[model samples]
Target: MKADTVGQEAADGLLPVLRELCRGAGADGSLPLTPRALHAAREAWGAAALLRLSGIARVLGEVRLSRRAVFHYSNPDCPCCRHKLTPNERAFLSLVRAGIAGQKTAATGAALILTEGGPVEPARNAALALRGVWSAGPV
Candidate 1:
């Protein structure tokens, strides 16, 4: 996991939210997360998560989102490095690929992602945070 990701998860309050995403990814843990129960989740998680997802949609180059709730990652490889993405990475990539983007104005959604409401273990949090950004490979 990346320090920046841990920092962001700590500061932004995205672990449990991400945990929930991982929970939804099912046994395989591969990306293109299409959580079966999104309507119920959106209410509990708020639309901002979707907006954060939109930011994800903007970040990844290959993906297909049928709607704000539906996410599909075409090439679920790390944009920065072609690493075997973790389940947590898959979930974040889903968000990164989910539609409903509005980084510039999705204040409500962004706040939901950062709202103080959960605990994030350092190691686990680091792994989860690492899913979002690119990392360098061994030289």
Candidate 2:
């Protein structure tokens, strides 16, 4: 845990988020040492953690590449989604918004995650998940 993840007791809840980070960074996840840690994490967290990470990276990538302020817009309704924002997502979104506004919050290095060329890097592959979530995603 990064000491900022709200509601969760420990870092075990962050495996999915980490996986998203690695995935967004284009990691194939085939490193020799990755499986051992992944297996342990999977055993500890179970399948839901993995399954819940759907589209997070894509949405975050959109947010990172956003030229407009995401927090300024209302999150669009999606009847297909059966979930809402979690405390963790709210907190992370606040941090990201604050970071974007140049506020001096604790979520340092958020700028790094908003890498240039992420959105237009691959054939306008940017996702529409950002329309549903201005702050965070399913994870």
Per-candidate Cα lDDT values, in order, are 0.32, 0.35
Q: Model 1 segments beyond 4 Å from truth? A: 1-11, 29-47, 54-139
Global CA lDDT computed for model 1 = 0.32
Clashing pairs in 2: 1-11
Distance from true location, Cα of 138 in model 1, Å: 32
lDDT of 1 by residue, 1-139 (tens): 3322332332233333343443455333343434522432354345444544333323321221112233322232245432233333444433422212312223222222322222212222322333343222100
For each candidate, what TM-score against the reference?
0.24, 0.28
TM-score, predicted candidate 1 vs. hidden true structure: 0.24
Deviation of model 2 at 135, angstroms: 19
lDDT of 2 by residue, 1-139 (tens): 1222233422334433433343334222222223433453355445543332333344344444442332221121333221334333444444444433334423333332333223332212223222233233332
Top-scoring candidate (TM-score): 2
